[model samples]
Target: MSENLKKDYQLCEEIGRGKFGTVFRCFSLVSGDDFACKSIDKRLLTDSLDRECLEKEAKIMQLVTGNPNIVQIFDVYEDDSYLHLVIELCNSSDLFDRISKRTFSESEATAVMLPLMEAIAHCHILGVAHRDIKPDNVLFNEWNLLKLADFGSADWFLGGKSMSGIFGTPYYVAPEVISGRDYNEKVDVWSSGVILYMMLAGIPPFYGESAGEIFEAVIRGNLRFPTRIFDSVSPAAKDLLRKMLCKDVSKRFSAEQVLSMSNSCLILIVLFKVEN
Candidate 1:
């Protein structure tokens, strides 16, 4: 840990752990405010590409700092051994954990998704693509507000340019990404669509026993709504899902377009209403 970080904040319990770092619930020495401190071990980031991605993630988070739906990064500290990022602390569970606890109705899912879409729109508008958009990356604050976190796979694609390389979770990864084709921010839309499908039906649109199988299914890009599971789902919700999950990248709905539909009262109303 950095000496400067310890001097500034009191690191508390371990809240999260990943490949490169562990997240701690920290309290600021000056203000006594709670925050999450992600302390990354510099030794683990021996690869130049890994270091570059880490730098990019910080820059991207800083770029989208004002977005309400995205988690805010407050401070950064570095020493010879560790790099610490002090970010807004989210006391509640992640989206994956919350959804696992109970099923969501259309209105409830819509409520959760609107803010998430807004977050994605904000990132896209800033020319940043959050290559990873799985439910685990979506968190909730103490007030139960949604916050999009983890930009490890994020990168810039300014001016609508395409990005290459495959960087996303298997189940939520876009087809273009799996195929090794140059893709754009629209990949986030596809991942969001997968999340919506999972939320509404209580299952993923595609599945398999192994990562390879899941990747194949994602590449095939066949979206199906089984009658038994989706019988209660509204047509408007399904329509939006189809648009977001469209295999044809050229025809897929952009984050802004989805926000536009959400902004329209008719679509919003239709999406929120439960079918008889």
Candidate 2:
């Protein structure tokens, strides 16, 4: 821990852990406010590329803090051994945990997705791409509002400059990423599609016994809406998925376009049900 961190805050408890670091619940001494502190060890970031990504993640978080749906970073503390990030504390469970607890109707999913897409669009508009957009990275605030978290995979993407690395959770990764082709922010849209599919169907769009099998399925780019799971889902919802999960990156809908259509889609679904 940094001397500054020791002076300013008191560590409470370990809240979460991921491949990159451990997150702790902390209380600010001066403000009496609570925060999430991500402690990343310097030794684990020995690779130059990893270190660069770490720095960029912090910069991206700093750039996009004020957005209502994205997690906010308050302060940063560094020491010889670790880098600590003091961010908005979200005590509620992540979307994945919530989903595992129960199923979500299309309407409920839309309610969750609209703000998500808006936040994503906000990030893209600001030139940031959240390479990881899975449910585990989506947290709920005390108000029960969804907040996008974990910018460890986030970076700024300038127009006409595409990224080539394949970085994302397996089930939600875009096909182009699996193919090792250059991709852009649309990759996030594809991940959103996977999330949508999972939300409505209670399982990922692609699944297999092994990671290799899952990657093969993803690369194949076949979307399955099994009658048992999706027969009750709205056509408009399915249409949006088709557009979002398109194998051809050029055919994929942007976040702005999706947001424009999502409201109308939900409204139509509601009307159709009422009429029936």
Q: Write the per-residue lDDT of candidate 2 for residues 60-99, one digit (tens) a residue.
A: 9999999999999999888888889999999998899978
lDDT of 1 at 64: 93
How high is the lDDT of residue 69 in model 1? 93
RMSD of every prediction: 1.7, 1.0
Cα deviation at 223, candidate 2, in Å, is 0.9
lDDT of all predictions, in order shown?
A: 0.89, 0.89
TM agreement with the true structure for every prediction: 0.95, 0.97
lDDT of candidate 1 over 1-276, digit per residue (tens) = 778888999999999999899999999999999999988898899888789888887788889988989999999998888888999999898999977777687778878888999999998888999999999999999999999999988999998688998899999999999999999999999999999888888888989899999999998988998999988777777888899999999999999887776456345556556334
lDDT of 1 at 259: 70
Which residue pairs come into collision in candidate 1? none
The TM-score, computed over Cα atoms with residue i paired to residue i, of candidate 2 is 0.97
